[model samples]
Target: GAGVSQSPRYKVAKRGQDVALRCDPISGHVSLFWYQQALGQGPEFLTYFQNEAQLDKSGLPSDRFFAERPEGSVSTLKIQRTQQEDSAVYLCASSLSFSPGMDEQFFGPGTRLTVL
Candidate 1:
């Protein structure tokens, strides 16, 4: 892909339902990241991957969330038992550099997940 792309740009999930959002990053990018943004707030990092290696998942709010990049290019973020607090815009970004200290991430438009 030429840039990061996320599917289901808008999603409405019933409370306690499970949802999966997908991201396709730019070609040959070495770093991928996921973030969550509640309305009126800045993005908060959820996880980061260096190629296929998940380096950080410190920002995921709870055990119900999981993410993977099985092939180092496309990624999925799955939320189980979604709560109203889970409603937010999920963003995916990719960078040419794997290192956090040097990478310049390019972000997608984001998937807006709403839990009711």
Candidate 2:
């Protein structure tokens, strides 16, 4: 894809359910980031992957939230034991270089996860 692509644009998960959201970034991008946005709030950083290495995950809300970029192009964010508070939009963004904050990050449409 020429741009970042996220699968399952919308997802409904029952309480305690597990969900995995996928992200396919623009080819050859060097940085990928995962974020969670609650209702009306801004996106909060969840993790960051530079190439195939997960260099930062300090923003993950809990142990139940996990993300990975195995091949440096595609990534997945997995949520375990879904709860009402977990209902939010999971966003994926990719940048051309390692400095995502300074580079222009191409964002996906995001995967909205609704936990009921």
67-112 in candidate 2: lDDT tens per residue? 9888888999999999999999999999999752588989999999
lDDT of 1 by residue, 1-116 (tens): 36788998999999999999999988899899999999999999999999999999999999999999998989999999999999999999999986538778899999999999
Worst 10 residues of 2 by lDDT: 96-105
Off by over 4 Å in 1: none
Cα RMSD of predicted structure 2: 1.4
| Candidate 1 accuracy as TM-score | 0.95
RMSD of each: 1.2, 1.4
Candidate 2 TM-score, true structure as reference:
0.95
